[model samples]
Target: MLINLSKLLSGDQETITEQVTLEMEAFVSSIGTFPVVEKRSFPLKVSKIGADKFLIEGETAVTLDIPCDRCLTPVKVEIPLNISREYDKNTVEEEAEDENLIVGYNLDAEQLIYCEILVNWPMKTLCTEACKGICKKCGANLNHSSCTCDTVELDPRMAKIRDIFNNAK
Candidate 1:
């Protein structure tokens, strides 16, 4: 969804509010792609703040299927988007950030929402706080069952001593 800002830039209109529909089925980035399972339409507002400057604001929510960091299990993560950005024609500060939501006099609503979601993505996701994670040695989910792999962890400083004992066999 693209919103024309020519009227607002010309000062013929002080503000423009439109109910924009999100047309993204998934969010793609360098990390990975997450499916957008749900979304809702919301009103986006663009208002003139200064000469050749404007403010874009909107609120919407979307649910994504993000995997758990420790267990690799898919979890439903609802990301609430309270999008706000400043469009400037004088400097390239936004371009440096790769915001690229605004090009010339057109605002990319989909890109704006995508950027907001990327900024607010969770750093860590877990199925539960007490999740036991997976058995690294056997590749089994510890939360569901136990594994027979050695649980002892030896310090690196004692590796040479353990190697000497093994040579005796």
Candidate 2:
């Protein structure tokens, strides 16, 4: 969605409000396609802060299917989005990062949404808080079934410590 900020820049209105839905299936880093189920809607509001500066704020909700960090199971996760960006049509700041400062009369809503998604996404996604995780012995998903493997493998670097304890006994 390309937001034409001409009116807001011209002082035609103090603020402009619009609702938009993003339906693109874009590949995300670490996570697969975002909003694996449906489109995401954003309720955005843009206000004139100065002669050429504007403030944009919005909220969007998105559901994504991501692999659980522990069990590697595909889990449905709902992410809440809250975004705010400052824009200056006249000033171009090279140090300003994306979403923090936008220049020009046209605002790229899709890019803004992508930025919010990245900011809100967690580093790890788990099906449950107490997931058992997969078994390292047989590569079995511990969350689904139990494994009979001894599962007591120790690091080779700690062999000296184990031998010292054994000799003490």
Candidate 3:
């Protein structure tokens, strides 16, 4: 979706409101591509603040299918996107402080949504707080089932203390 700033720039309307639907199925990030489980509707509002300045604001909710960091299970995570940007047509590329702000007459709605998603995405996603990760020996999901591997629960620093106690005995 491309939003034309001509109306606001030309002083035809003080503000413009539009309900836009983003049909993007996936978003690519450094982690990987996260699939969108639900499409979102954004209520976008653009208001002219000055002769060459505009204020853009919107809110949206989206659900994405991402793998749990521990178990790698597909988890549906809901992300809330709150967008607020000031567009300055007279701003130079070097003078702009925010990279997400629009500088030209045309604004890419999808790209802005993508930027918000990336910004709000969690560093680590877990299906549950008590999720037991996969077993190190057998590669079995500990949350689903138990593993037969004779896993020892030990602290390496206490090994020398154990030896001293054995010698006293």
Q: Predict model 3's lDDT versus the native.
A: 0.80
For model 1, the run of ten residues with the poorest summed lDDT: 90-99
Q: 120 in model 3: Cα distance from truth in Å?
A: 1.3
Candidate 1 lDDT over 1-169, as tens digits, reads: 9999899878799999989999999999889999899899999999999886778888989989998889888888999988787867576464454357678788888888888898899888898988888988889998899887766667776987899899988
The TM-score ranking, best first, is: 1, 3, 2
RMSD per model, one decimal: 4.4, 4.5, 4.8
Error of 1 at 16 (Å): 0.5
Q: Clashing residue pairs in candidate 1, if any?
A: none
TM-score of model number 2 = 0.73
Question: Which pairs clash inside model 3?
Answer: none
lDDT of each: 0.85, 0.74, 0.80
Tens-place lDDT digits, model 3, residues 43-62:
89999998777787999888
The lowest-lDDT stretch of 10 consecutive residues in candidate 3 is: 92-101
Sequence-dependent TM-score of model 1: 0.84
The numbered model that scores best in TM-score is: 1
